[model samples]
Target: MNRLNEQFEKYLLDNLPKSKSFHPHFEKALQQMLVAGGKRFRPLLVLSVTDALQPLLLRNALPVAYAIELLHTYSLIHDDLPVFDNADLRRGMPTLHKTYDEVTAILVGDALNTHAFFLLADAPLPADTKVEIVKELAREGGIEGMIIGQAIDCWFEKKKLALDELKFLHIHKTAKLIAASLKIGAIICNEKEIAKKLYDFGIDLGLLFQIQDDLIDALQDDTKAGKTTSNDENKNSFVNLLGIDGAMKSADELVEKLETGLEAFDTKLKNNLKKILNNYLYRHKNL
Candidate 1:
């Protein structure tokens, strides 16, 4: 699995480029951030959906997978900016704004945002399919999705939100892209029925993921988390609203809910998806 991850990372690195004589500083920062990898979890979902369906499908899904990762990284770079989270570290290294200048970080993030769509638009797939992919990405990553989620997050800081509102915030901010990743993969194979099922699965998985991330930030060390921790005091997080044990229990319930939803799909895909979610959740329990 790690080898597959390495190969996917290389694929992104190989494709990432700029004119040789063009501005190098911002481009260099973008490259460095991409190299300082995370779990590649978003891309993995795209690839895994295709792999579980059929390995050959990876060729069709790879570009979309890479685009999702690029878009996600773009969000991270901006999220860590001084005006946003002001995070100093990411992936165990100084954040883009910290390593480079804030100006460079902003531009690198802008470049990644536009570049992600360019990749999706250029993906080697049927024209109709490519168009749908682009639309899905925009819907998930744009104002109706991740962007709005961020706005809500910023607006709600230091203010308590209802549980449903909190779920809405995360479902759009964090889960939409993940849901889109799987949906895009299934669309590559024209598997709409299955895609919807996996999309729901992705949303549930994302909810669990954000909850775990919140718990980690509230309970773990920066050194262990590869980024700052104990920063959720005023943020809209599961920890603040649900408390630690309540958040854990809610996450477990979500896992069970997802498992039930997965039963609507093929048994094999359902089982594999559950196993992946379980593994990721299991590892974080220690964090």
Candidate 2:
């Protein structure tokens, strides 16, 4: 692992929401999902861009990376609610609702979601830069993006969406946030030209990620996945839509596109992306 990657785990651990309250377990519940380990994929995309483009700003970028992580964790918490996937496990641990109560889980997700913006607002970057970062995160992770996608997914369950529509659903729900992470890092580094380019690539990368996840869900058990598996039977997932063989073909085409896309960046960004993506690029095949 990259040393920065190692350091980020510690940084995230040290910076979780902390407080004293009359409500006993709320504090613990707030910190539960954050502490429960999952792949720190989104934040690392932000950090990698900043690290490659502007090492001097790497330390300053921690807040940016952390803000993305907080938003992502909050989404996971709410996503695992009884209304959504309702899975008992997440990141290999019992979900927040199961560990505590549904109300606690809901409130904790709310807290994390709100705190993400607060981090951006409180970051030490210039006013304009902070505004851009906040706007990008909001546009990608809010109603225009993740929320609408989730709404579509839940609303359209058991109803088959066309291939393009499924792509739209996952792109907004998953890809846009991933795209925002890369673009936000570029924004922080003041690399405006490449920011859009990275974001475009991130969209495809995130779609590939979702497909790979669907494949994992179809092929792996809960014990292997550390979360619920075979649960997308009614959901409009790629595995359910395209079947395993067709999904694998889609993943293959995406991997090729992403490889070509990675090569287009300057050496620093390309190599950085390659390093992060190597372990994950063809991961579905193994499954």
- The count of backbone overlaps in candidate 2 is 0
Stretches of model 1 off by over 4 angstroms after superposition: 22-24, 271-275
- Cα lDDT tens digits, model 2, 1-287, are 68668878888888888768799799888888778877889988998899899988988889889999999999999999999999988988899999888998999999999999998999889999999999999999999999999999999999999999999999999999999999999999999999999999999999999999999999999989999788899999999999999999999999999999998999998988787899888999899
lDDT of 1 by residue, 1-287 (tens): 55446668778878874635467575688677788878788887777777778767777677888888889999999999888888988999999888878998998888888988888888888899988889898998999889999999999999999999999999999999989888887888878888888787788888888998998998888898998778778899988999999998888888778767877777657655655565675555675
What local lDDT does model 2 show for residue 114? 94
lDDT (C-alpha, whole model) for all candidates? 0.83, 0.92
- Say which candidate scores most in lDDT: 2
TM-score of 2: 0.98
Q: What is the lDDT, from 0 to 100, of the residue 142 in candidate 1?
A: 95
TM-score against native, each model? 0.94, 0.98
